[model samples]
Target: MNPILQARNDMLGQMEQMRELSAAPIRPAAQIDGAVAEAGVGNAFEDALRAVDAQQHQASAAMAAVDSGQSDDLAGAMIESQKASVSFSALLQVRNKLSSAFDEIMSMPL
Candidate 1:
């Protein structure tokens, strides 16, 4: 089997796992206490940042593995690399928007 196809299959397997995770029912925000809910929202952003960092590491490792002949899944490596790039770009955009919003709020007349 082609390594590219195998890498695609691996990615599909991961997607299925993600789908399974998404299948879990989400708890409504109203169900939680106000302070706890707010804290969770803050932690969620931190968690997302950590997740992006972890994915970036994984992508880097994948590329290294391919380069070193430790892995033959070039397509998988490239896909992971792109995922990391996209995630970083998204995070950057979010940061930019947040900064703009903060600046706008600060400049408002009392």
Candidate 2:
């Protein structure tokens, strides 16, 4: 099988996983002492960060396996590496957008 095709398939699988994760129902926030508690968005974002970290670790493990001769699938390792890189880049973009929005809100006149 071509490496490019395999990579594309892997990417599509990852996108499907992301879609499932996003489709999960968000738990309602609780009221505490007249203040609303944290919503599910925070948990969702944290879960996404954890998922990206897990992908990075998985990619590293794949590369290590290839290096130690425990695995002969260099192409698979490369695909995992690419997937991790893309996920990290996406997370960074989200963080940047959130930061800019925060800054913009702070600059608004009362």
Candidate 3:
């Protein structure tokens, strides 16, 4: 198997673990009065969008660096750009689904 393919699989496994950890319950510190529950649905979506925005910014910077010849390999930049594009596309789809849900709810008879 190619080294890149192996590395990609490893990264994906790690990301899955991270996602699982994020979904798990957390115990609040003594300083905090009560347990803050895992993020609400809306907050979770907002946070995901913010993370994607940050990734998009980083990818843009990396692409710029490659364009200016500041970076040696173009592959890394290309990968980052693709990641950003995929993330943005996913976010757009989520937004569209949410909007459709909202419209459906509004159309329901009371």
Candidate 4:
């Protein structure tokens, strides 16, 4: 097996594991006696934002460690940085789509 292909597979598996771990259980609004559910859309969005922020912080810390000569894993630091950058970009894209959708709905003639 090619090393690059093996690495790609490993990364994909890790991502899948992360997705499963982060999967929040959904509860119908009625199940909570009118209390707001933690898995509500707004809460989900907030959670995603928090996760992205944490990723950014982790990447920053990894880079700092490398810079300070405390860690020799430059490649790992770079990968972390890239992951943070990609996640941030994804979050921004989602926000832009949501904003556009809101604007479109507001302009609809009732």
Best candidate per TM-score, number?
Answer: 3
lDDT of 4: 0.87
> What is the alpha-carbon lDDT for the whole of candidate 1?
0.86
For candidate 4, lDDT tens digit of each residue in 1-110? Answer: 55356658998999998898569576666664687555666787899999999999999999999999998877778878998999999999999998999899999999
**Would you list the C-alpha lDDT of every candidate in the order shown?**
0.86, 0.89, 0.84, 0.87
Considering every candidate listed, which one attains the maximal lDDT?
A: 2
- Residues 1-110, candidate 2: write the lDDT tens digits: 77789778887999999999689876544433356755576787898999999999999999999999999899989988999999999999998988899899999999
TM-score of model 2 (CA atoms): 0.68
**Residue pairs in clash, model 3:** none
lDDT of 3 at 93: 94
The order of the candidates by TM-score, greatest first, is 3, 4, 1, 2
Q: What total of clashing residue pairs does each candidate reach?
A: 0, 0, 0, 0
Q: Deviation in angstroms for 45 in model 2?
A: 1.8
Q: Give the TM-score of candidate 4.
A: 0.70
**After superposition, candidate 4 runs with Cα above 4 Å error:** 1-36
lDDT per residue as tens, model 3, 8-83:
9989999999999789877465435566556566987989899999999999999899889998657777777888
**Candidate 3: Cα lDDT at 43:** 87
Worst 10 residues of 4 by lDDT: 32-41
